[model samples]
Target: MIDVVVIGGGPAGMSAALVAGRGKKQVILIDEEKPRNAVTHETHAFLTRDGTKPEVFREKGRRDLLKYPTISIKNSKVLSIEKKAEDTFEITTESGDIINAKNIVLATGVTETLPNVKGIENYYGSSIFSCPFCDGWEMKDRPLILIAESVQALHVLKLLKNWTDNLIVTTNGNKIFDTDQKKMLEINNIRLIEERIIELKGIDGELQSIFFESGEKINRSGGFCTTVLDNRLPFIAQLGIKVNEAGFVIADVMGHTNIKGIYAAGEITGPSQLIVSASQGHMAGAGIIADSCEEAFQSIQK
Candidate 1:
């Protein structure tokens, strides 16, 4: 059995495998290549890797892991996981291969539910985005809009103000903001449109204007929108990993999940930046190494 089996070969999974491999543990990293950031053009806030394309960053990371003979990467999808014993897990892949792992690291990230607005998909990852910190600089000083369907809209609105002065907030008819909040935005010279978005008209993946269901329209170069994030992994329910009220897997700062032999990192734990996710993966690697070493020492004493 391998010392660690990391599910999802994104930054978090790759980082975990590298750390565990460096600790002299045999590690297997499996991925399906459908990362949450696959649509994103470039990743930001990762020092020395800022503005690097997601694919490029991942390639560099995998290349670095090649130096460690103990680490192996598989391009595959994990179908399910069965805990056969306390220290053993049987992970079934789509190809019908079964992998036995002493420990499991779930780095499967969250999936975003794009708004139902027409033509938004064409602009997403280009003109429209979720994180201001990631795409704000690119749209700086441009006419921007904040589309939200949740309370988190307020937080995003506040963050976007730093990147653009001309801003508008819309709840897509959800009424996420109250009268007081609307007044506050108006006081700051920001427009609040509570109308439902009918469509996003753009050209060449660049947003030009948004049409409201009420026949109103506003011109916007680009904007950010709030998305519903959920952990959609079937193994989370199968393994009985505890999830918080926000529907995110619950893991301590050290990446210890409620399940003894299972740990989690990256967006699966919660909302995290790229660097933060990588750091969490590193911690999870250390935790796995410590636990495996302790188990071996105890076996020797026995």
Candidate 2:
């Protein structure tokens, strides 16, 4: 049986597999190649790898793992994972391959539900973005819009003040803000538009203007948004893993979930950046190694 099976080959999975492999563990990193960051053009704030494209970052990460012979990367979709035994799991892939491993690590990230406005998908990751820290610098000093659909909108509005002063906050027709929040926006000179968005007019994914159902139009260069996020995995309850109130896995500092012999890292565990996910993966990998070694040692004493 393999020592570790890491699901989702983004930064977290790749980094986890690297650590496990370097520790002489037989690690297999499985990926479907659908990364959440696939929409973004460039990744920022990762030391020594800042501004690298998402795909290129993963490619370079894979190349670094080639030095470890025990690490194997597989580009296949996992259909399901079943706990065959107390310390063993059977992972079934869409291609009908079954991988049995002593430990499983879930690095599966969250899935973003963009705003319902028309043409948002085309503009996402280009002229529009979700994370202010990631894409804010490029949009500095430009006229921008902040589109939010939930209570998180208030936090997003406050966080974005660092990037640009000229800002407009819209609720897309939902009155999610309280009196205090509304007052805060007004005090900051941030126009609050509660009108429903009809469409986003742009050229080649570059945002130009926002149209409301009231026939009002606002011209803007680019903007930011905070949309709904959901955990992408379907087997959390089946595997007895605990999720927090935010629908994210409840992993500790070392990425240890409530389930034994199973671990998690990255956005699935909580909010994260590329570098943070990679760091979490490394810690989880180390935790798995330490636990597995203790188990092996105990077996010999029995």
Candidate 3:
């Protein structure tokens, strides 16, 4: 049995595997190669990897991780996971292979649900994005739109204000915000348009304008959108791991979930900066090692 099986090979998973291997634990990293940031041209705010392509960072991480003989990576998807016994988990892959590990780390990030508007898909990650901290600098001083269908719209609007003063919030026909929230946005000079977005006008994955169903067109350079994220796998539900209201895994500071022998990090736990997710992975790895050591010591005493 492996010491730890990390699902997902993104930054968080890679970091976890690296740390676990360094801790003298046998590790297996499984990834389907469909990183959430695959469409992003560049990743920002990462110390040395700022402005680096997402794929390039993953390539470097993979190369470095391979240097550890105790860590192995597989290009496959986890189909299911089951508790075989106390302190052990059995995982089944899409290829029908079964693997058992003492602990599991779920770094399976979320997939974004884009606006139903036409042409938005082509511009996602290029001109349209979700995280202001990640892509806001590139779109600074430009006319932007905050496309949201829930209270998250207010949060996105507040953050985008730092990047550009010229901004509009497209409610996309949802009026979920309360009166006070509406007043707060108005007082801040952020226009809220409760119109359904019909389409996006763009050229070759670069957004230019938003066309609303009310015959209104908002010309925008780029903007942020709130996405409805669904967990990539039902593992959280099947394994009875507690999740937040937002459908994210609930874990402690060190990435310990309510379910023993299971941990989670990255976007699966909560929305975080890339560097923050990597740091969380390192902490989770350390926690796993600490827990294992305690278990071993207790067994020896018995």
Which digits, one per residue and each the tens of the lDDT, describe model 1 over residues 153-190?
A: 88898899999999998888887777898888989889
TM-score sort, best first: 2, 1, 3
Ordered by lDDT, highest first, the candidates read 1, 2, 3
Per residue, candidate 2 scores C-alpha lDDT tens digits across 1-302 of 99999998988888889998998999999999999989888998899988899989999999988889999888898888898866689999887889999888899888889987877999999989988878889988889999998888888888888888999988999999899888888899899999999999989889999999899999999999987879868889888899999999998877788988789999998877899999999988998998878988999999
Clashing pairs in 3: none
Worst 10 residues of 3 by lDDT: 112-121
Report the number of backbone clashes for model 1.
0
> Per-model C-alpha lDDT, please?
0.90, 0.89, 0.88
The true-versus-predicted C-alpha distance at residue 121 of model 3, in Å, is 1.0
Residue-level error in angstroms, candidate 1, position 302: 5.1
**Which segments of model 1 are wrong by more than 4 Å?**
299-302
**In model 3, which regions exceed 4 Å deviation?**
none
Candidate maximizing TM-score: 2
Greater TM-score among 1 and 3 belongs to 1
What lDDT score is found at residue 225 in candidate 3? 90
